[model samples]
Target: MSRHHDVVVIGGGQAGLAAGYHLRRLGLDFVILDARTTPGGAWQHTWGSLRLFSPAAYSSLPGRLMPPQEGQTYPDGAHVIEYLTEYEQRYGLPIVRPVAVDAVRRDGDRLRVESGSGEWRARAVISATGTWWRPFMPAVPGRAEFEGTQLHTVEYRRPADLAGQRVIVVGGGNSGAQIAADLAHETDLTWVTQRPPRFLADDIDGRALFDHATARRRALDEGRTDTGGVASLGDIVAVPPVREARDAGLLKAQPMFARMTATGVEWADGTTAEADTIVWCTGFRPALSHLAPLGLRGPRGHIPTAGTRALGEPRLHLLGYGDWTGPASATLIGVGRPARDAARAIAELLAEA
Candidate 1:
């Protein structure tokens, strides 16, 4: 007989873990299905030096508090993974790892989730696989003909890997800045961006500005008071570490490239630069291929779920869909409110059923 569950959550990352934790508290029968061998999702795949911009206070899972890191401004990736592993052990949440989901389809009134080893049926499903599923790489003319190494920021590991190479870092986001700054110590680097960057201030005193936005977002979600629009890093968050690279001239800002040639990149301003490696720090796309029949995606292929309604699907919901009513939607802190709200909504649905 095939295994059955009350609810099945895909992806064992922070979002999925949050949902599983709440389901357990509600006394619901559920199981968490993950592709990786362990929890922490993308954090495990990130560069070893990665850390959360938000403080430890805001990074905790549902019931447990993240261990105190008094003097550290941000918790590193290893710390995050350690905390998540502890959270799993504390709750004894059922998580099946190394199981890659092949497809998820609604069959009659039940949803079928198939993996290489077996299949699972559930009355409801939570697609908690976060947005970083797919990395976005822009198509530059003649890119295929370039005689050099090329990789996405997602693939970059450490600055030592780029030693003695002429590197061009593309995109102006936090990852781009941090990577560029780190690489400047060992390589000839140039930072290229299409838009002028909007910088945020470093953590003030001991409080991170990201914490304030997350708090406000939670309040607005709970219907406390009208907190106004979603927050952008442009307003308060400090410019990331890349600004230091610009000051040292190791990194020179340039416009979006007009085109790419076999020899080098051509900027819109009619200038050119040669590079041995190109790192595209572009961005990411939501991973929702498993949610095909829902018909929820917009023109850009992102799900159109609004205000945690699950886009009108029965017992189907999302936790961190991106800035629903607040300024930031992609951060770990930003997703907490929605995760809690999603849990409550699922509990209510189970009650009604």
Candidate 2:
């Protein structure tokens, strides 16, 4: 028998789970389909030692409070996973785990979701897969020739793995800085960025950059200028941890690499540096290849939905998409509003049908 649901929320991360909680509270019948064997999408794949820069207050779900912590700094990945697991158990949200959805298509008035398990029918679909589904790695010449161990920041775990090795981290984003700083104590580290980062204070007014980005998003929307790129203000700025790394001399600002060799990386400015391992922290792309028949994507191949507008599709919705207003468009905090809007929209669509 084909399973049917009023709504199918894809990607059982913070966004999907939050939406599920809201939808259930509204007395709606829905099912969350997740790719991982368990919940906590990105957090599950994140480095084990990774910690949130934002304080516990900002990291809480919509209704529940994050467990109180003494330190003003953010909690680590394990703490985050624990909270997410508890949230799932607390809400008793129905989530289909390890069912990697391969594609979604519309059939008449219903939507069909195909995965390894089978097909599922839903009145509407909420794509809460989040933006970190695809890791972004630049294509550099001779990258394959580098005989040393190379891994993306997504696969990185602990510093002990890189101990005593000369590591080169690419990109000047928060992850790059954090990974480089974390490994510097036990390894020789060099950070390669396309450009010098715009450093912010370690702890701005006792708030982290993630929090500041959420608060400043409105200002960014008002002052935003088109740079002919998909990235917004939040996408380009450094978080608090990156700033701390710079202040502590754990990371040095450098230019992007022109090419890679077995020995080291060659920079655009005609300089070379040796590294035993390379960690690419460039960024990530949306994993939307599984979504077909949806002409809602933009020129850059990202889902194009503006400020909860629903993009003219009655039963289709996008969640956790970045660049809606200002810089923090892709953060977990930014997704809260959109998730609520999407849940409401899905409910209204079903009610009308």
Candidate 3:
């Protein structure tokens, strides 16, 4: 027998929690399904020293503001986890853990969510499963033949793990920059990017990036030309550690190598450099494999969304993947708006039904 709910949230991360908060307030019969054994979502898996781009004041979900961390302007991963654990408790959101959802497919006027624990039928399904599980690693030629260790951002934990090794951090995103900086003093580190790294001004932080997203959203809603949002700002934010590393000449990047060698990498010009490990900070794609059965994905593997609702299948809503679902929706502070919108839309959707 499948449990039934008015709505089902497919993640327990910041995005799922945000959706649950609104759904509870609206008095909806909903449940949040999380795969982890405990709370904290993806934060529990991040590196020990990973810091937020904004202060706790600026990084919060709806209803509860993340309390300021003592002696820390930008909170670390542990702090965020603490806040998330508390946030779920504070709201008493209904969530089931250790339930890995295998697939979501269409049913008779509802959606069937198949999971390890059991199954669920819901009038609406909100997939807030973010990109953490789907780490993207570019297939540099000869990568399989390389003898050195290679790990993506998801597998990284701390600098001490790679201490004393000759490490090359690949990709130019925030993760690449932050990880490279974190490893610089501890190892012989080289940073490589397909193009040169673009760092945001020292003064700019997540708050500024959110504001940019807001403006771009407003412009698009008004049918005006879109202002490229955070991309217009730069690729990487110069948070305290990264900025300090750049100032100290420890954070310089080289162009991406043409291919990997048996022991290292070679540039297009045939220059070769050796390394003990290659850390791929190459980012992630949406963890939507569970939704593949729905067959709503486009050529890019993204579900076409109108606001947060899937265009092809209105019963499905996607949250927290990125700006495509909602502007800044991937960030802690930015996810609230979309979560609220999705819940309200579901309410209206159910009402009409």
Highest-TM-score candidate:
3
| Poorest 10 consecutive residues by lDDT, candidate 1 | 230-239
lDDT tens digits, residues 1-353, model 1?
46898888888888788778888887889999999997788888887555566668776766887886655656777888888888888999899988777777777777788889699998788787776768888988878988999888779999889899988888877677767777888888888887765556554411355556656767876989755442344522333444466566665567778777776788777788898999998888777787776566666876656665556576677665466422343565555556666667777877787
**Residue runs of model 2 more than 4 Å from their true location after superposition:** 70-72, 205-245, 308-312, 325-329
> Could you list the CA RMSD of all candidates, in the order they appear?
3.1, 3.5, 0.9
Which is the better candidate, 2 or 3, if ranked by lDDT?
A: 3
The TM-score ranking, best first, is: 3, 1, 2
Clashing pairs in 3: none
- Residue 182, candidate 3: Cα error in Å is 0.5
lDDT of candidate 2 vs native? 0.73
Cα lDDT tens digits, model 2, 84-192, are 8998889999998888888888777888888998888999887777667788888899899898988898889998999999989887766777787778778888878
lDDT of candidates 1 onward, in order = 0.73, 0.73, 0.94
What root-mean-square deviation over C-alphas does model 2 reach? 3.5
